[model samples]
Target: MTDLSARDIERANFAFSVYDFDGSGTVDAIYLGDLLRALNLNPTLAIVEKMGGTKKKNEKKLKIEDFLPIYSQVKKEKEVGSYEDFLECLKLYDKAEDGKMLSAELSHTLLSLGERLTDEECESILKECLDPEDEDGFVPYAPFLKRLIAGPPEEKPAEAK
Candidate 1:
């Protein structure tokens, strides 16, 4: 808490408030994981449980004060996926080691494997991250992975007319 910048604290507080749906100054323990993710901390289920997220709703609750420490701790401890990590995973699909793969295969994997993204979700990612496929239908994956890892571009505020 002491080391977090004012803006970081403010962002955490705002995220906490959004999840504190009842205005009760507390959030259900089950939502702890969601709150952590909302703050852009990718805590695993074990980490969430260690931080007091209960499997059952209302079994426990977290006040903003309590959440701040947990958020700080997880933020410090969690290592987000790096570009190399993602590339290595994608490499399994790129048998030729050509740094490119079939765009359709990538979309199929996204929709069918691991976390199993919904059609809309997969489409949204493809729309944003994919480049124009070549004649043979292959696409370079490094740029796509880079954009995906970087997340959506930040929206600029509209100029006052």
Candidate 2:
């Protein structure tokens, strides 16, 4: 929390609040892993335990104050892979050397691979970043991969005349 910006702290608070279902000002311990994932942190069960999360229902709870440090620690330790790494991996399936692959294959890989995404999550990404599938169901993958890694292109600010 010490190194986080005001906006980042605000976002963490908002995410934590979502799981505080009972308005008890604390979240159930069992939800810690889900909460961390919701905040884009890839925390393992050990990490969750170290951060004071317990699997026993209603046994422990996390206040936002306690959650902030955990969020900051995980965020600092998270190592997002480089864009080249992703591109290389995707190229393995690009048999045609056309920088395109079947849209269905891409979705399946995302749904089944490491850190698997839920169907809804996969669909959300595809809807946003994927081009319309061709008649044969292929879609250009390079651009889609770029968008996935770097997010949508930012709009340029209007220049003052």
User: For residues 17-128, what per-residue lDDT tens digits would candidate 2 score against the true structure?
Assistant: 8999999999998999899888776676677888888979899888988888888887776455567877888888888999989998899989997678899999999998
Stretches of candidate 2 exceeding 4 Å from the true structure: 5-7, 33-59, 118-124, 147-161
Worst 10 residues of 1 by lDDT: 77-86
Which one is best on lDDT? Answer: 1
Candidate 1 C-alpha lDDT tens digits along 1-161:
44677898999899999998999999999999999888877777778899899999889989888988898888887455678987988898887899899999999989986657899999999999999999989999999999997778999999999
Off by over 4 Å in 1: 1-7, 54-59, 159-161
The 10-residue segment with the lowest total lDDT in model 2: 74-83
Error of model 1, residue 138, in angstroms? 0.9
Model 1 pairs in collision: none
After superposition on all CA atoms, what RMSD does each candidate show versus the true structure?
2.9, 5.5
| Clash number for candidate 1 | 0
